[model samples]
Target: MIYVVKNGDTLEGISRQTGIPVWKIVYDNQLSDRNVLVPGQALLLLGQGETGEVSGGRAAGGYAYPFIEPEILGQAFPPLRELLVFSYGFTFEGNLIPPPQDDLWMVETAWNNGAEPFMVLTPFSGGAFNNQLVKVLVGHEEIQENLIRQMLAAVQDRGYAGVDIDFEYVLPQDRAGYAGFVGKVRRAMNEHGYRVSVAVAPKVSDSQRGLLVEGIDYAALGENADTVFLMTYEWGYTYGPPMAVAPLDKVRQVVEYAVARIPPEKLVLGIPNYGYDWALPYERGITRARTVGNVEAVEIAAQYGAVIEYAPIAQSPWYTYRQNGMEHVVWFEDVRSIEAKWGLVKEFRLSGAWYWNLMRPFRANWLLLS
Candidate 1:
């Protein structure tokens, strides 16, 4: 079970209330300051009936087949078990559509490399999430059923291990409908011996408001799906201000919330294999960040004679450099950051960690996973 810390709650208080030891709480959550407790912070409480013991070893997984190159896949596929192709989309009428025809070869390659290939389904059009498409599909019961039927057929025909539902920009009004859709899919897939997983936004509370977190009902979805991948990266994004993609503190909050509602074994934390380089003097909508590989970000720093600094709180590496009289900031993951994320998996005893992509070359990350 997970307990949300209240404003005046202490570790000892939570321990007593849940009949769990304070040390267990401190250790499970990796709390450095036991005295300081933030409201909305999730605390894992052991001995709960539904919440079983954390498994000894977690699976290693990643999203591949889109940005990933053939050469990179040859090297990176060995350490991964679950490989979600990115991805197939849906039309407004709930008709299934395939990704680029070229992706089929990558899917075959992943299967040949001993990775479990999962077809990713999304509500995207023209390379962006289409909110209207989700509303239509979830709102109509007949359409939902048709979509799931097609998905099961597709998964079975392609010899896929499962289907990963990556529906984004879902409207809050369709919350119950979305959960219902997942339940329907889970039943259909389980009957056919296929897996059902969902990719959800990083949310710290059920009441957390926003288009990203609103439609996802974590408790309900956890009960229906085989696994749920928390898209924990992108706190610092292409158009947003420069910061760590998945800050340790923010990631911790999300994990805490998720484990409280969903079982730890069914949770997969998301890790980013890429980073961002932003020009300074960021304007809300004007300044844009360029996406860069983790390794490339470091080379950029060295090229500009910039000093790389690590943010202890975020557990991410960043550096500032000047070019053409303009200051720029680059924040990215390194071996140190990857290790910290993997440590979270061990501490929380989660199902495992999955990279947002296998597109870029991050040798250190692969070595760590191996």
Candidate 2:
């Protein structure tokens, strides 16, 4: 069971209310400082039927970006504690851009919540993947070594459990260099008692051609990093056609290909926690989809009297509505859709599922995870 911490609530108080032992709560959450309780903080009070034991063959994880608000973090802390890793970092320009001072609270809070905190290192610039950064890093041996050294230093300084390499839009010619970089980083980090994970684009075949697919050599990366987060979502993007963010068929194909090359135990299926609402009559360049929270999508359906519909093939929930005399369609995850995706974890024998984000309040999703 999950309990949200209210004002003036203490661990002892919560134990009294939930009939769970104080020591058990502290141990399960790995709470080092019991006196520091924030409002809206979520506490997992294991009940009679709940084992709080993860399946040996599977694990669960999520990505918590640097910009998440404290209140959202409080609410998400409970379920995230059960996850294997809570990635709390983002992509920077081969440098570690410290999160805003205010966000440091989340770092401590995450540790208290029992999730192994990971830092994400990426080659993104101004909201898009920068190809030039990848080129510079891969082409210059000295620069690559220096950057990896700095990264390991940052991880050590920040007390992070590991680092996630999220370099995207890498040049196809640098495939060998990319794998080489990961191998070097992994070897160094292993010596330093840190874990290394890599994020790769969803690919159905080794021969898949694309800027995203070409740079990532699955077998080499799998051999290097401890875990590989397969980004299986985003088929329906902000500027694309209206459809499921992570259509089941597409996700399955990626998993099938991944398990063939990467060990199933080291694969983490990416699950999108949010969805998109696109206006009808979408034009390739003119139309843009507005991102909506999973719960907000339902409220939208109710507000507009739109009838929610389920796409059987996609295993996702969607609805159409009219606002300002314009037709709009929304495709988002519900309990049913999320549960269906969880089934894939077992079907593919994957390590677990990793949520794209935890900024939104999806009580149903949390309950399903519980």
TM-score of each prediction: 0.83, 0.82
- Please write out the lDDT profile of model 1 over residues 1-370, one tens digit for every residue: 5465566788888787878788766644445566766443344555433332232246777887565667777656567778888898888777899887556676687788888889999888988998788888878988988888888888877878889999887888888888788888888998988898999999999789998999889998999889999999999999999999999999999999999999999999999989999999899999999999876775676467676677889998888889999999999887667778888888988989889888887654554455
lDDT by residue for model 2 (287-344), tens: 9999998867766765776666678899887888899999999998876677678788
- Cα-based RMSD of the predictions, in order? 12.5, 8.9
Error of 1 at 295 (Å): 0.7
Q: What residue pairs clash in candidate 1, if any at all?
A: none
lDDT by candidate, in order shown: 0.81, 0.76
Deviation (Å) of 116 in candidate 1: 0.2
Best by lDDT: 1
Question: In candidate 1, which residue ranges exceed 4 Å CA deviation?
Answer: 1-57
